[model samples]
Target: MASGFSLKDQLFNREKTRYLAGLFAASHAGFDPDRFEAEVMAELPALELKQRISLIAEVLSRHLPQDPEGMAAAILNALPPPLDPSLSDDDFGDFIFAPLGELVELRALETAPDLSLDVLAEITKRFSMEWAIRPYLVHWTDKTLARMEVWAEDENYHLRRLVSEGTRPRLPWGQAVPLALSQPLPLLDRLSGDPTRYVTRSVANHLNDISKKDPELVLTRLRQWQAEGVQSQSELDWITTHALRGLVKQGHSGAMEMLGYDPAAPVTAHLQLGPGPVRIGGALEFDCMLQGPSDAPVLVDYRLHFQRPGGKLSAKVFKLKQTRLKGGTARLSKRHPLKAGASTFTLVPGLHRLDLLVNGIERGSLTFDLLAQAE
Candidate 1:
């Protein structure tokens, strides 16, 4: 991202707002595009991204008919068209259409719950309703999930994705639903064999969220899926790897074994660190060599223990390489940059430690000093 990049401004600007207003204007002649655009633009610049979405939806609700049926009809009519059907993945549709989902959540959830689901089904075809659907899942859990069961088989991939994404335990910027962790498993089982990567990715992510709380449950479900032979081997492999990423980072033996890596493999290793102390803005280079049984697979990782305030240290894992030993030997090197100007974590100048992990086991460790950048 370039400097001074404002995501809220980029997504909900005057042009996009006008475009939405025009769509509604074309559908409802009585709809005032000017007022809709003006109200949205007024508070938009001051609000955050999600707040801007609420502002647009609020403004739109005032312009539409107060009656539920008429409001839903106008929104359905104003839609430009469902997003292009040909693309398999990465077509998230326009963010401008997201507010319409909020409109559905607001107007129809109470007076017309089933009708709200219907509108959401259509609006999701234009833009995903994952965020909007959470409230329904909470207040009308069984009914919404029953409807999602049918959607799991829908022809539209976006709707199919919502069956998983909407119910995810850890959806980004989404409200939580009061349901058991395994409640959505049946839906995931149905979607596990989805042909589209867009749907499968959501299934994988949903499983990943489940894994955080119950690793064994996720692993068991994966085993069941594997036995069913529903999804292709290659795709299943991708899903398994992605879903267990958190466990693998934590050196969970079950996760490593499932991915065909022997966490306890007998391997000898040595690490060589470039001369320190490394500056805050400089790179920390290192070389590592491993010796093991012939052709044994290795999942190599490194951990950097950083010095934090209050004389404590925090460790972060990083991937190094994934390869098999060639002639009983494997060598890897990396030039990891200790970047400055990071907004999340500040680099402190002090003693730091680096540890090498082979097949999830720490093989070698070393310590070095990090210097603050010169003014």
Candidate 2:
């Protein structure tokens, strides 16, 4: 509801100064107005707590464009200490105190190299979930990785936890970093067999994020781990499902193959012509059959690939939920009408490949000869 002024202006305005001064006075803290304002603004109050931390972040982001390190230090020093543990359940306490704790941790990460590892370890210990540290964790070069690896071996679970916990790709409330997702496998391998559940869950989430963009890579890793008998069924299930989600959605051939479905099985496809292809108006009907294996039920996905006038191919996958394997064979079929533009089309008459992709991993190709009649 509050608008008009930029976040910076809203933060350093007269009203905020008075409110901050009053807060300082109530805490029995001595304040020199000029110095206090300068210091406090650098580490702006989390006054609205998480609800308004974004606003504070905007103000800091704008003001500290050049010296994030110095600004971070000033913010950390300005925070109130942790609130009494007993007051954690109090609503007002959460709004007032929790933000202070979180802000301290956030700034601690911003000033990580200057802060002792022990100090960073302590902050991570207290605010493992709420603290924002992804920026620092992601920027780690090989040199920093070496330093972190040493910390990963520390006896303190918190510091050791930081190695996995801080770099988690799917960590709730943490930013998703694709590069971190790529590099975390080695770190996860180091911690996978550890006696701690805390570390293993982080490993699982890291694998989960990787599965989205590169299902094959995750599958390869899982297969290797399974071969070694090092990965549990639970880990395999998590990785397989997450990694295959996108492929399944798109009905990619590799995904179906990984899932153990055959795509090249001989099948009959029937095409029911609709209004013939016109400039931009036409539709077609497609019906197809998929045979299943003798021993188990088969799940099949359907895809249609259209060739354009320029000889380029575009494919769209569709899931056929009714297909099922029975006895020695599965009778899988579907009837769908494709809209002209919705279905594949070529601006010019030509031969095109229409592929039926199964379970996103297997493919069946069909050729269609199209001729465009002049108006």
Candidate 3:
């Protein structure tokens, strides 16, 4: 087993990596375990996360049953069983459970030619096949929508969540379904009032995705949801806060106002990045001071413009803290991590800029250099 966080590395864990070939060989006829094992592991260390997932799908295509429906059913048969309804309480939450879901994703796509919602319906019950459903959305738009309409009413929370998550216009790392991007509301309308937290969270995320492209639609819908008073205020607030996350970060006045911030107010912001040229693994200590004229609410967050691989800079927001300030003064400090461990980000030796943003307005900036780790 390899120890790492990247999808490529995560896939090759304690048991699944070594035995995926064996599982295929044992389940299907004509797949030589030795050959498949050698092929998969040989290509593994060279590929990144998404590529590795594609490799798994391709390997399955080469070895699985020739008939599409048969291949889909065989993949489902290969899955251990219906997951315990309570994922958090059972081993179902463990990483060991992921490989089955990964297989279901491939099975969803591999069996797409047949367009059997029944197979996907069954497969998703055990493992999510959201990525697999994208192809059908592209090739058989109407049919895919018909099936999704049915999945929306599904008893399983996972399937209902998938009804929103799978159709996200810009699902992060998942396939982009353009139709949903153009007309996000209709699908959202179906899942909007869902009672389950899991389903509602996905619905919030889907609206967040749309907020990136079409902010008004999301704002209008959120406002409508609040006006209609269908769901409790707390649930609606969660959706509003999450869905408008990007907008809030960008300091969109409308979004800020909706979230109960007065962007028009004034505040003095003091930011400091100290002890320049820190080692890669050390922490970057920061201090901030906020002084407001009147009793006004403000949302505070920070952005770090990182040095990218190509020498270009990309900014990422890190949540610092949220608080309500009295008329006078407030002080906040954070010791942010410089070193990377299992996170997606890799620590690179370069110069970076940090910004203090209050109510989405950049107030202060500092330049700092990160040195390579000490030997």
Candidate 4:
């Protein structure tokens, strides 16, 4: 080992040394590593980016296992703002900064009550809905409820974006916040008539999620919203489709009743089983029909409730559009393939119940057995 290495010499000696120095400078503040590294990695910017990411990952991995909270804070503090602000717009910055920000907020949640709300608000102010809202929604609490309620009224388009995007139940690539599920009517009431198309789309998705769990409530709200006449055409369209998603797909009798349609109209369903079931692989198919009165046009929605390996039933709905019911006959049909995992693995091996919900209420049911077969 060298007897007396200068700070300058130490930094130039190795990649690890450079990384450690950067980490320390960021943690301590006022020591400009960017100014210093301008010369150290001047010739190889790509290498610099890679080394920085690796260094951050290594530090996080080493410390998170022992002190996730402290480690998270350190990581956020250690992130260097991009050397060129333009470079910040790229995915590399997102990869480096997004996780650091999310982890910092999550850890803050663990250490400080309601910290996520403030952190999330700051993040929304800085980034778009596509980036910040998901993390905040997944970890939301009543502690942040008042703040979020206020955000629902924000004039900023992005903050308004947060209102709907954060509360969506089935947001793709996003975690579902169950708490928001119970009291959506108020939030929906606030955003249902928003002028922003971006915000309205999220409202529709949120309503769609609600429809699956409680179609009656969704339909009630839809009726109330329609009666109040406070909604725009876009809002009405969103609410109508989402509130009826579950019922329409399942062809629930009650759902039809709510939609001002008669369920007593003749209807038929057919089930077609695929190749024999395997222990870990197999699929199922369904077909159905709806016969309308001589002069009335009928819309039939259908869905399949699957019973998994553990005695739990999961329902998935599909839309069947509109068809003219010739007084004599109107045909409605559907096909579905079931896969293994959370949705299909909850039903136990014994006899299981498969129900067909027309609008929002069950109209028909069938029993089927799941046997553990050889692979």
TM-score top scorer: 1
Number of backbone clashes in candidate 2? 10
Alpha carbon lDDT at 79, candidate 2: 42
> How well is each residue in 98-121 modelled by candidate 3, as lDDT tens digits?
344444445554445444566666
The TM-score values for the models, in the order shown, are 0.98, 0.47, 0.77, 0.53
lDDT per residue as tens, model 1, 1-375: 898998888999999999999999999979999988988888888899999899999999999999899999999899887888898998888999999989988888888999899999999998899999999999999999999999999999999999999999999999999989999999999999988999999999998899899999999999999999999999999999999888888888899999999988889998998766688999999998899999999999999999999889999999999999989999899999998979899999999999998878899999998889967
Q: Across residues 43-103, which tens digit of lDDT does each residue of candidate 2 receive?
A: 5544433445444334333333235455444434444453333322221222222233344
Which segments of model 4 are wrong by more than 4 Å?
1-97, 104-119, 125-143, 167-184, 211-215, 247-254, 266-290, 301-317, 326-328, 332-375
TM-score of decoy 4 = 0.53
lDDT of 4 by residue, 111-176 (tens): 654544554554454443333455554555554556668888977555666766666677665555
Candidate ranking under TM-score, highest first, comes to 1, 3, 4, 2
Question: What CA RMSD would you report for each candidate?
Answer: 1.0, 10.1, 4.7, 11.7
Sorted by lDDT, highest first, which candidate order results?
A: 1, 3, 4, 2
Q: Which regions of candidate 3 are displaced past 4 Å?
A: 1-14, 17-65, 72-79, 86-115, 180-182, 272-281, 293-295, 305-314, 340-354, 365-375
lDDT of 1: 0.93
Candidate 2, residue 161: CA error in Å? 7.7
lDDT of each: 0.93, 0.50, 0.71, 0.54
- Candidate number of the best lDDT: 1
